[model samples]
Target: MTATDGIRVVTLAGEIDHDTGDTLRHALDATGESCPRIVIDMGQVTFMDSSGINILIAAHRALSEAGGWLRLAAPARNVMRTIHIVGIDALIDCRETLSQALSD
Candidate 1:
């Protein structure tokens, strides 16, 4: 995790399924109410399933309710496809690069 440009960036790697989804959820929750804007660096995330999507949606809802937002950055092709399939790409901003997410 890193904090720069007034955003908290959480770098995730590998597959995020039921087994690993909790880790991501915990990381999101750890951001706390103080730090609402989050950029999840998914450049290294090769796969994601429903569980992963659920966690992301939950985080987004929490952040949005707090008047903040969550962004996804650089998801792998397959992961991006999954996110789109679940329609999360519409609810959250998905960027091709971390810099883009941090920029806007």
Candidate 2:
């Protein structure tokens, strides 16, 4: 994870499921404390389950309480579908590219 211009970028790879949710949760928790804007790069993620969504929702809540926000950037189709299906897209901003996410 890295931050620039008040936007933190977390680039995730591989699948996000119950097994990997803890790691992702930790990363998000660490950043959510201070960063007002977080952009998660999901371009490399091949899959995402409910567990992954739960982590995102938790992080979103944390950031919101601090007057911060979370964004999802360049998520793969499968991941995007899951996000949309779960209505997370309505709660968070989903960008088409990392550059766009950072710029916004």
Candidate 3:
């Protein structure tokens, strides 16, 4: 029997903006195809703006529609607060670590 293990880990670092958003989006799209569980590791992401949040939201929606899940792992304080302030936390799951997110 073939066990269907569907988990994808995306580790992101540095700033996320219009220039990088497209690259991130493309990467997510490619990864989302095989993994039902998408975990974005943002522990090293030092900066994130509104465009970054939008990219995440868009990916979340796309994955959800595909009967999958999207989650954020270990966002920096500023990134976490931005997500909270923008209410993105209500839409996607956020955890303290990649291990925690994967365990869930």
The per-model lDDT (C-alpha) reads 0.89, 0.88, 0.83
Model 3 agreement with the true structure over 1-104: per-residue lDDT tens digits: 01124677888989999879988987678342644667889999988888898989888988888888888999999889988999999999999988888885
Once superposed on the true structure, which residue ranges of model 1 sit more than 4 Å away at CA? Answer: 30-32
Error of 3 at 9 (Å): 0.3
- What range of 10 consecutive residues in model 1 has the weakest lDDT sum? 26-35
Candidate 1, residue 95: Cα displacement in angstroms equals 0.5
Residue clash pairs of candidate 1: none
Residues 3-103, model 2: lDDT tens digits: 88877789999999999998998888745265477899999999998899989999899898888888899998888988999999999899999998888
Model 3 TM: 0.88
Report the alpha-carbon TM-score of model 2 versus the true structure. Answer: 0.92
The best candidate by TM-score is: 1
TM-score winner, 2 or 3: 2
Error of 1 at 68 (Å): 0.7
